[model samples]
Target: MTTTAEHVDSGKAARKRVPRSGHARWLPPVDRPDPVAVLERQGRDRLPELLPIRYGRMTASPFAFLRGAAAVMAADLAGQPHTGLTVQLCGDAHLLNFGVYASPERSLLFDLNDFDETFRGPFEWDVKRLAASVAVAARENGHPAHRAHRAVRETVAGYRTAIRRLARLGELTVWYERVDAAGLLPLVRPARQPRHLGSSLTRARRRTSLQALGKLTEVVDGRRRIIHDPPLLEPAGAGDAASLRKIFSDYRSTLPEERRLLLDRYRFADAARKVVGVGSVGTRCFLVLLTGRGAGDPLFLQIKEARKAILEDHLPSGPYLHPGHRVVAGQRLLQAAGDIFLGWMTGPQGRAFYGRQLRDVKGVADVAGMNPNRLLAYGRLCGTALARAHARSGDRIAIAAYLGTADTFDRAVADFALCYADQTDADHAALGAAVVAGVVPAAPGV
Candidate 1:
C-alpha cells in the first residue's frame, strides 16, 4: 500500500507530465471526424424510426447538443494529455445529470442520476465535462462570457475544496458522505438561490410510484393498464409482454435475497414501451408496472438496454463483460445511496439490460430558467457532490494534491470550458446544416 506522502508525490508528478495550463488549449485536429458522421454512426443500431427524434432533440440548443454528444467530447478529450489519476467517471457528467433522488432509506439526496456511460478514467475528464456544461448553460441563459468563466471556475473550486476535505477523512466516512437536498438550502445565498427550488423539491417528493399510477395508467375494462400515447408511451405487444415476464426472474436473481423477497410480493400488472431522454431516444426501453397489497398500491420499474460506454472506445476496457452488469456495478460504487431494486439481466437475442425504479422522488434543476448566480450555485453544488462520489472509489489524497491550494487548475478548466462551448456551437451548427440538407431526418418539436 502507498503512503500518504507517496500518493501526494505521485499526484505532483502528474502535473509535470500534463501541465495544468495545458488543459485550456483546444483546436480540432487535422484528422478529426465529422461531428455529424459520429452521430450517424451511433444511430446505426438504434431504432430507425426514433433516430429522427434523437437528432431533433440534439439540434435544439448547443447545451442540448453537449448533452447528447458525449461521444464527440469523449474523442476530443482523449486526444489530449491527462493526469492519469483514474476514477469511476460519470462519463456523461453534465449539469442536468446531477439531481435529487430518493435513497433506500427514503431520504432525498442530490447526486449524479445517470450512469449510462459510466466508466473508469482519469478524474479530470468528469470535471471538464461538468465545467463545459456550466459554461454552455450560462451562455444559453444570456450570461456574459466573463460571468460564464466565473461560474465554471467556482465549479472546479467546489470540486477541489470538497476533495481536499474528503481526503482527510477515514474510508468509511468518505463512503458515507452524501448531500442531503434539504440541507442544501442553508448553503446558498438567498438572493442567488432560485425561487423554484423549494417547489421543485416538493414536486419531487410527490413523484412516487403512486403518483405515476394515476398519470401513466387508466382503467380498461375493469383492469388497470398503461395508457397508450404512441411513439412515446405505447402498450407492449403480446410477444414483448411475454419476454418481459420471462426475464423478470433473471433480473430478480441479481438482487439481494431480501430485495428478491420484496420484489416477489408485487404481482406484475402491465408493461409498455417508453421513449425517454434526448440521447436515449432510440434505445430499447421498457417500463413494467406491478401491484402490491391491493389495486391502489403500485411499483414502476424500468428495464433499459445498456450498450458499451462511449468512453470505452477512448479508454482501456473495464472489468465487466456484460454492459448491464457494468452499469449496475458502477452505480453501486459511485452512488452514496443506491436504489434497493437495482439489478441487471440478459434478455432475448442476448441484449444487456439493467432494471431500477422508474421514479422515486426524482427532481432535476431547471437550468433554462436559472440566472447567472443561480447557475453558479447549482454548478458548485454539482461539483461538490461529484467530489464526494469520486472520493468513494478513487484516491482522494492524490486528486487533492494535484489540485493544490492555488486557483491555477480551476482557471485552466474554465478556459477549457469556454473553448469547448465554442466547439459545441460549431458542432450544433453542423448538425443543423445536416438537417437542412436532408442528410439526417429530424422530427422537430417532437
Candidate 2:
C-alpha cells in the first residue's frame, strides 16, 4: 500500500507549477490500493472511541448515528483497490454534505458545506466515500443494488465529464462560476408523489438565514443572544464572555486590517453553549451572536472545536505545524467563496477551534427526494465544483489526464462503494449493540 506521505509528495509535485489555464497541461498521477483488505481492516476495530466526540446531540436524529463511523469506513476502504490519483479531499463528501450557502458576496451559491476532515490526501478517497454513501442511502430507502448502481454510475460519470469541462475553462472562469440556490430549484423540483421522507431537501432549500436559525436565537436588551438550553446551550458568565471578547480581539490579528475593520462594526453580545451536528457532539461549540447597529441587524457566529485530523495519526505531517491551521488553510484554499469570518483562535485552555457564521442561507439537496435524472445532475454539479477546488491547489491537467476517458474507474468505485455500504450497516449495528450492552450510553431520541 502507498503511504499517505508518499502519495502527498507525488500529488504535490505532479500539481506543482502547472499553468492555471487551458487543457494542454499534464494530469496528476492516480494513487492505487487494495479495496477488500481496506474494508476488512476498517471493520475489525470500528474505532468506537472516536464516536463520543463525533456525535453532537444524539437527540437530533438517527442520521447522526453515522457521526463516529468514519474510523469504521476508513478501515473498510483500506481493503479496497484505489486509483493512485490523490488531491485535497473533502474527507467526508456525502451527498448531504454538498449545499447552498451565502458566499462572502452574499450570493446564494452551492458548494461542499463541511470541512472538518479536509486534507491533502487520496483523491479517490472522496469519490469512493461519496459513492458508498449513495449506496447506503439507497438501501435505507429500499432501493435495490441495480437501481443504486445506476445512480452511482451517473454520479461517477458526471464527475468525470465535469472535470474535463472544468479543465477546458480558465482559472478566472472557474472561480467566478457557481451554481446558486435559485438555479438548483428547477433541477430539484418537489417530488410528484410527495412523501414526508423526502421533504427535508425542499425544506432545507427554502431555508434562509432568518428562517433556519433566527427563532432559536435572539437579541436581548440590545445584545445578540442564543437562548440557553442546558447541556445543549449553557450560559457563559461575564468573566467567560469577557474572555471570549478578548479572544476575538486576538483573532482579528490573523486577518487583514481591512477585514478587521469589517469585524469591528459588531459589538460582542451574549454567548451561550450550543450543541451542533452529529460527528461534532462532545467537542466544545458555541454561538456568538454579534449585534451591529441594532437588534434586527445581527450575525450568529459559531466557534467549533478543532482537533487533529483523523488522517494525522495515519500520515506524516507536512509544512503545516498546527492541525487546526491546516484545516482552516485547507478550507480557504479549496473553497472558492469561503466565509468572510473564517478564522482561528486558541482559548484559555489552549484548545484550538475555527470560527465562522452559523447561518448564511446554507442549505443542501435532499438526496432521498432526488430522482435518477436529478441525482445525475446534482452529481455533475458536485463533480465540477470538486474539480475546480482541486485545480486551485494542484495540477488540473495532470489529474485530468490520469482520469482519462474511462469508466473502469467508475465501476471500481461502485464496487468499493457497494462493499463499504455493507460495512456501514454492520458498524451501525455494532453501535446499536454497544448501546444495548450499556458500554456507551445512548443519547435520548437518537
Candidate 3:
C-alpha cells in the first residue's frame, strides 16, 4: 500500500500536470459542438411529447439552462486539462443539486441529493461545475460581477479547508463525516440570514409520504388512486400498471433481506407517470403509491429510468455495467448516509431503472430569493458538503496537498466560473433562438 507521505507527494505532483492557476482559462474551441444540437441528441431517445417541457423549463433562465445542459458542460470540461485526482463525481453538482434530505435514522443531513449523472472522473470537474453554478445563480439573482466572484471564491476556499481537515482524520473518521442540517445556520451571517430558513426546515419535515398522500391521491370508486395532473402527472395505463407490478419483485430482490421484510409490510396501491426535474422531464419516471395497515399509512416510491452518465463518454470506463446500478453505488459511496430502500433493476425493453422513496424530509434552498450575502453563505456551505462527499470516495490526502494553504486554486476557479457563466448566457440565447425559429418545439409556461 502507498504510504500517507507518498499520497501527499502524488497530489502535489499533479500540479505540474495541470497547474492550479491553469483552471482559469475558458475560451471555447472553434469547433465546439452546438449546445442546441447536443440537447436535441439527448432528446432522441426520450419521450417526444415531453421534450418540449424540457426545452420550456430550460429557457426560463440561464441557471435553468445550465441545470438542463449537463451534457453540454460535460463535453466542455472534458476538453480541459485536469488534476487527474479521480473521485466519484455528482456529475451535475450545480447549486440546486446539493440539499438537505433525511437519512434512514430520520436525522436531516445536508449533502448532494441528485445522482442521475454520477460517475468517476477528475475531482476538479465537480468543483468547477459547482463554482460555475454559483456564478450563474449570482448573476440570475442580479448580484454584481464582483460579488459573484467573491461567492465563487468562498465556495472553493470552503472545499479546500474541509478537505485539509478531513485529511488529518483516520480512515473511518473521514468516511463517517457528515454535515448536519441544524449546523448550517452558524455558517451564515446572523444579520443577513433570512427568516424563511426556519420555515423551510419545518416545511421539509412536513414533506413526508403522508403529506404526498394528501396532495397526490383521492378516493375514487372506493380505491385510493393517483390524481391526474396531465402532462405533469397522469395515471398509468393498464399495461403500464401491470408492468410496474411485475417489476416490483425484481426491484425488491435488489434490496437487503431485512429491507425486503420492511417493504413487505406495504401493499401496492396505485401508480402514475410523473414528470420530474429540469433535465429529467422526458425520461421514464413513475410514482408508486403503497399503503400499510390502513388508509392513513402511505409510502411513495419513485422509479426513474437511468441513462448512461453524462460524463461517461468523456471519462474512462467505470465499474458498473448497468446505468441504474451505477447511480445506486455512486450514491452509497458518496453520501454520508443512504436511503434504506435504495435499489435498482432492469425494466421493460431492458432499460435501467432505480427506485427510492419519493419524499423523506427533502428540501432545497430558494436560490432566487437569496441576497448576495445569503447566497455567499449558501455557496460556502455547499462547498463544504461537497468536499466531505469527495473525501469519502477520493484521496483526501492528495487533494489537500494539491489545494495547499494558498488561495491560488480558489481565485482561478472563480475566474473560470465568471467566464463560463458568460458562456452559459450565450448558450441560453442559442436555445431561445432555436425555439423562436421552430427548430425545436417548446411548450413555454408548462
Candidate 4:
C-alpha cells in the first residue's frame, strides 16, 4: 500500500486539476434547498432498498435511522461554504457514536465507534453533525431547545479548542497520547446523582473473548454449529456458507504475507449470519468461528459489507477507486491501533467487504445517562481524539492556520446544528408517517 503522504498529495493534485469555477466549487454553496425536505425523501427510500437484502430478518425501528441520516446530513452540508480543507471525517458524528472500546493492547480507549460512512470531506461537516445530534438527543430526552443549544454550543467549542491545542503539540506527542480508560474518571466527574455513567463505565471494562461468545452461542451436538436468534442473527444457508468458505480462502490471499502467516494458525470452523449495528442493518455481515487447537478454543470474526462512502460525491477522488479498499486503508491510516485481522476481499458475487474479529471487549457509552457536565467533558475528549486522527493524514499546521483562535467556526457549527436538528426532527416525523401509512413496516416497541 502507498503511504498516507502519497494519498494526500494525490488527493490535493486531483482537487487542483478540477475546474474550481461555477458549481464546481470545493466548498458547497450556501443557498441550497430545505434540508428537511431532502431528509424526508431519503428516509422513505433507504429502508425499501435495504428490505430485499436481508428479508424478514429484522423488525424495523428507528434503529436503522442512522443509515438514512447520511443523505440528510450530506445534502445539508453541501449548502455550506467550507474552508476548502478536507480531512477524513467520521461522517456520522452523533454523541452515541463516540464511545469506549478496548484497544488491541487490552486497554480501554475512547474513539470513534463507527466508520461505515467515513470519508475525506470538509472537517466542519463532522462537527456540525455531532453538534446537531447532541441537540436531537437532548430534545428526545425532554430537554428544552435552549438547554440543548448550550450542549451543542459547548460541543462545538470543545472541538475548536481541542484542535487548536493539538496544533501546538509536537507531531510525535499528538500521535502517542490517547485518552485511555484510566483517564476517563477524572474527565467525567462522579456526580451525587450519577446517571448510568458508572454502570456504563463498568460495562466497558468487562473483558470479552472467544470463550465469552461461545457461552452466548451454543453449539448443538452432532451438528456442532453456532445457532441463531431472531432479529439479531439467523442461520446462513448451505450455498451462502459454502460461498463464504470459498471467499475466505481468497481473503487470506489478499492479506500481507506476514498477516496471512499469522492467520494460518487458526482454521475456520463455522460461519453464521450476524446482525450488527444501527446504521449497518441489512448489509451482508457474517460471523466466522475459528478453532485454533481444539473445539473449545475459538476466535469469532466478522466480515461486513462495505459500501460507497457518503463523502465520495464531495471529495476529489484519486488512488482509491474501490470504496471498500478506501475504507480499509483510511481506517488503518486514522486509527492508532486497528484489528490485527483487518483485511479485505471481494466475495464470489463480486461484493466487497472487510473482515476483523467479531468479539473484542468492545463497548460504547450510554448517551441517555450522561448529565450535561459529563457530556461536555466527553465531547471534549472526542474532539481531541478526532483531531489526533485527522492529524495522522492531513497537514495539521495548515488546518490550524485556517481555524485560528476565533470562535467563528464554533458559532458557524452551532448555527448549522440548530438548523440541522430541526431538519432531523422533520425527517423523524416523516419516518413515523411512513410507518403509519404502511409504506414501511414498523417494528413493535420502537
The residue-by-residue lDDT of candidate 1 on 161-201, one tens digit each, is: 99999999999899989999988775543554445578778
Which candidate do you rate higher for lDDT, 2 or 4?
Answer: 4
lDDT of 2: 0.62
Model 1, position 162, has a per-residue lDDT of 98
Task: Score every model by TM-score.
Answer: 0.99, 0.80, 0.99, 0.84
lDDT of 2 by residue, 97-140 (tens): 78777777777676777888777765666766677777676666
Clashes of each: 0, 34, 0, 0
lDDT of 4 by residue, 277-376 (tens): 5556557788887777776677777888777776766666646765567667877777766777777778756778888777666676666666666665
Q: Which stretches of candidate 1 lie over 4 Å from their true place?
A: 192-194
Model 4: runs farther than 4 Å from truth? 1-68, 190-198
* Candidate 4 accuracy as lDDT: 0.64
| Reference-based TM-score, model 2 | 0.80
Residue 176 error for model 1, in Å? 0.6
- For model 4, which pairs clash? none
Local lDDT at 135 for model 2: 68
| Residue 364 lDDT (model 3) | 88
Quote the positional error of residue 26 for candidate 3 in Å.
0.2
Q: Flag clash pairs in model 3.
A: none
Which stretches in model 2 have alpha-carbon errors above 4 Å? Answer: 1-64, 78-84, 186-214, 218-224, 237-239, 371-376
lDDT of each: 0.92, 0.62, 0.94, 0.64
For model 2, what is the alpha-carbon lDDT of residue 439? 56
Report the poorest 10 consecutive residues by lDDT, candidate 3.
188-197
